[model samples]
Target chain A: METTTMIGQLPEVTYAGVIIKAIIILAVISAVAGFGTYVERKVLAFMQRRLGPMHVGPFGLLQIAADGIKLFTKEDIVPQHANRFIFMVAPVITAATAFIALAGVPVFPDFVIPQEVPLLGGIFVPSIASDVNVGILIVIGMMAAGLYGPLLAGMAQANKWGIIGAARTAIQFLSYEVVTGLSILAPIMIVGSLSFVEFNNYQGEHEVWLVFYQPVAFVLFLIAGFAETNRTPFDLLEHEAEIISGYATEYSGMRWGMFFIGEYANMITISVIASMVFLGGYNDLWIFPAALMIVLKIAFFFFLMLWVRASWPHIRPDQLMWLCWKVLMPIGVINMLITGIAVMLVLE
Target chain B: MENFLAQITTIEGFAFYLFSALTIVLFWITVMSKNVLYAMTALASGMVLISGFFFILGADFLGVVQLIVYVGAVMALYSFAMMFFDATRNIKENNTNSAIVFVLGGLSALALVLIFAAPIHNESIQALYPMHEGVGNAQDVGIILFTKYLIPFEVAAVMLLVAMIAGIILAGKKMDNSLTESMDEDVEDEIMKRKDLK
Candidate 1:
């Protein structure tokens, strides 16, 4: 069950660190995602020069815990006219897909689900849960694949507001997904492979974070990241101004909270992605006390999301689409084309 | 036999079946579905799912290209075309022409059963070169395509370029044959006049 115990059992299997590692990752991310909510609220409050979570047990650590308890106990109301089956499955699917990504995310270089110990061969073959070399692509790809949920959820709800929310979400997500992808091209171009493990090593040697190479891309990604998360300036899909309440407006209790939690969880995942792609994930040199590099890197972006939330006001839906499609997309195309050329030149 | 069977029923196998079934089912429904809009959606799903199958088969480049080219580009083109045409609920039909649909369906089902039931002979397994040390088949596949098939690749590029140009021209404002001919003639005349000026 523990790391050392498994290590003890298979001395011959040098790469036997895989199985129990999955458990640790699962536990760590869930706790992080749950606690991340409390961290964001507390950090945001403090940043606004306000006290936060002082009343809760020990600096508001129990704040997120209490919210979880509340959701669990709250009476779930299935909308009278809503498609019951899909409505139930929608939130569950959203939560599960968000969790599904942590499986392939490499916390440490060598940590993975255990390898097949072919006793004859003593090669310490390193691997993740699923090492397709296109591990990062699969994560992004699967993330895009789950967009059907919101779209279906909207239509299935059979409510006018739900349809508006769903349509806005679908358009918002797909358009920004393009920018999210193009922003990544610069990193992939530099790294010369799609493997995340290799990407980590690539950043380690690049002497600077990816933002240094691609500043425009970093900004572009930040905006697109906001769009993808359905946050402010890009959060017009759930707009209170124009649309009546917006998608999942009818959803009550935990069902609604699943979407709420899922959205925030996505923000964290995007932060993790940005960290991985640009901010040198787990690679804070000197500025951070050596022990807390990963923690600091994650925490910085978690704060960055809050900063954007507090600092920026929401944009109109038309403007949101225009910014992504017009301003970001062309720059993204050029970034990709330029990166591709650079990679080819370097390879040659 | 057991190993092959195991491989066929695993996640990889299920994906193969799932995507293959997706391609066929949606495609069949696209043909048979009463609603034209619904049929179009099905066709798009079929193409996308087929590309997904390509992905599961480790045809990564092909799969992504399939999605980008077919589902993304071609389907968009299809829907744009569909939008221009009138397809309302009035077009919905039960136009089966008696029991032929049933007979054909039964025949297809029987064919599928026979196909899966067919036995395999591993005649080439003993001769299969063992997984050995080298750049592997990916490199070989690449090398052969680029080197040996370089001429075809270049030719294909040229053809694709021509097709793309033609697509742009045709997808623009609709023109009669006479208008298209006159435009071509006018362009030729301009080219000649420019040559004279030079």
Candidate 2:
């Protein structure tokens, strides 16, 4: 009777459950990162009115697999003058930090495996790897630390272009991090919690998303998020036109692939955070389940990123810095202050 | 081996040992490495491991703050090290008075350790604020910081603002010096032209 009662209640988590969830997250996110490249190519091709990667598989679905094989089999080259250890470790650091940041993110709604399963029955898996109270802060902090990856990589390569790339990475990432933090501060103040779960719960309970109240913050965050992930328009760190692949000039084969994976993973993380904080996160709307809604929101954000990349021309480095320090940062701070006052007034 | 595995299976014990080991090793690497870049990298890792220790102690807010401030923001200083110095060149430490300095450093460290460990050894340690049930770590920190430590916090903020202003002034002075030097050169050139005409 007790066992049945326990089972009827919310499923309990075990060590095995955490491990399984982590593995699932790693595998699924990496696969999705690969698939994102295919989507980007197709989206850009459509914009340019050309077929992209049609020769690999059906509509180039297997292009990612082919690319993977090529990256793995291609000759791994280290420049003769490069700092060997740092050169090798840099790309791995980028990839590792990107995946580590995902730990705080709630990728899906919590679920339990049925009790009938052999040896691993009725295990609860929370949406987040660790439901840290400072989830958003940690995620952003880890992403910020990822700046060292490019900074070191560029400096280690013993190439003039790489050094320029590293310098750009430092300035770009540092300036935009302030914007990202301040923009998110307004929502954090309103919700009075940094946990993504609380953010989601607030939206659900209030029947309103934070974006409605903090529109300026949402816009600032979106712009800063694009720059943080080193996406187009603000991708000065690795701008091909100027720096010739930037910090990645000396990397080849799997090393280069790691940087690509890191970039895509970061893009996905930004989309997830945006949807959770600004959009109504993982909550049922109309007829759709919460899980499906979140996935749709994330997909839409990802597509938006690609659309913007295709449509917009890259900005000059000076313009990027000016926009970050002068325009977006001031807007973020003012937005945060307004939200704080409004929240205080409502409470009183 | 069985006991070790059992101890490690307990999350708290496992985390404590792991973070402690990482901190010690990384700290050594930071201090002893010949390459400045490697030392900076090791120092960053050490700082991160210290944050891990905070996490294990359930001070989540402090852990995240440490990460953001030390690992993220402070790294800008390390980036300057790369630009100002050629990383490929081996950094050789001067050995003058090395023995005397090492002895003094070791003695001070030992004294410091003894001073800290003496209290814990006596079993006289008391918790100032025993953690209460239903109070989150962040809330507790915020409450204490704003209420009890408000003045100190504000002072620290002011100090940081002053430091930022000082940095700006210092950088501005360098630029101003260059501009004045350029003007002096132009004036000297005009004087030489007048002398030649005479």
Candidate 3:
């Protein structure tokens, strides 16, 4: 079946190549996620007129390494009343789902390893690990599944704050999921394919970013993405002021670090999706190459998320729910309906 | 073991067996576990594993929908509700009628077997929407859903809408009243305030 499926593809990607690519994605994304925290701290500090982590090493360039060492060396602690098994499993769920979601997202353009690269030479590595036809949906699905990490972590810890965090996690993630799906439906309808590659190619071929056509969707997706990732203005899940770090109150050492990594990874995933789906993906600009273009777009989104985080204040839970169900969801549905009619007219 | 392993040549075959085995084990744990939290977690994971079966069969759209709908939304809601209850404690089950339970279980098992076996033996049973060549699985499913099975699809949508409305009405019947506060005191205060205003 695998062979049959790959018969007509432009390049026949090998299993070995996919495995290698998956490994590369895992290592690179994990490293990038760690680096993201450093960048976020630096950016947030700059915004607040503070010099953050300058004493660590060269303006805190090696702060990631320092943090990594600290996390690794710190004692793993579980609350006395916590469910030990689920507590241990929760962070893995978060980290694993975050990485798995990246499987369907194209981080880079497809390229073949040169013949001189020894054993891995002449291998064709596709942009995505698995470019299943329903790529976007599956990526979204995996991210939605990532809610379990926080939900389970908070519930298992047996702390009041953790339970509150878990409760917030449930409502926040579930509510935004509707907005995310509905908002993205416009672009999916326009492109007529769920594959990120297809969305990229469609924009490239038309010489127009999807954001230009579906600006409302682009904005809605960004807001929902922020909430889904539990960023500021919607970071009620772990709102320190009210709940004392929310679901992560009982987590210590690398378990807590795993949640942090998962969050940063999810941020990157959302940035990548926004870039690919709305901002013309990895397509080459007039002066820039495809690779450089995609990196810049993704970087802008990552910085934008941090910028929003630095600037915005958190919303109340009731307000968040009201904004989602009564505001964003309705707008998304209307936008999708309009886009459907427009597409039908154009096609006809 | 070697022969069984050798029979699984494709990645799909290997994944099928792996997911099926894990799904069964997880579901078994879900059913047998005394703790509500543990049961819920196992059930959620089992749902996720079930999506693997769909993916293995090349039904990518169904796999994703299963993930999004079941594991992502439904199970998360289940866990959310589990928060209100003391989920960590073991649930003690009192089986009052083992004989009736066994008979009902056996009957359901027999019905399930018959339902599955019918497809194998029946020659006249045809798929309503045959898989279209050169079309993606998602597009194929969409075409069938919007065309041949449109009525059934609309009916299902309507059913879901009705269920959602009913759920809202049932859950929101006493939204204005605080469960923690005394209703009689509030009512008496309101009556006194009204009398004073008059």
Instruction: Evaluate chain B of model 2: give its TM-score.
Output: 0.79
Clashing pairs in 2: none
Q: For candidate 3, write residues A99-147 as lDDT tens digits.
A: 9999989877778899999898999887888878888999899999999
Over B54-115, each residue of candidate 1 has an lDDT whose tens digit, in order, gives 65756554554565556544654464454333333325465666589788989999999888
> Which stretches in model 3 have alpha-carbon errors above 4 Å?
A1-10, B1-6, B121-128, B170-198
Work out candidate 3's RMSD over C-alphas. 3.6
Top-TM-score candidate index: 3
- Best-first order by DockQ: 3, 2, 1
- Residue pairs in candidate 3 whose N, alpha carbon or C atoms collide under 3 angstroms: none
C-alpha positional error of residue B13 in candidate 1 after TM-score superposition, expressed in Å: 6.2
Among all windows of ten consecutive residues in candidate 1 chain A, which has the lowest summed lDDT?
A: A1-10
- Fraction of true contacts reproduced, model 3? 0.70
Best-first order by lDDT: 3, 2, 1
User: Which lDDT tens digits does candidate 2 get at residues B1-198?
Assistant: 998889888877788888889889988988888876677778887888898888877777889999999989886667755676666456888889999999999999999999988887676678797656556677888888899999999999999999989987987686535576789999999999999999
Best by DockQ: 3
Q: Give lDDT per model, in order.
A: 0.66, 0.87, 0.90
Tens digits of per-residue lDDT, candidate 1, A142-179, equal: 45544545654565565777777767766777788788
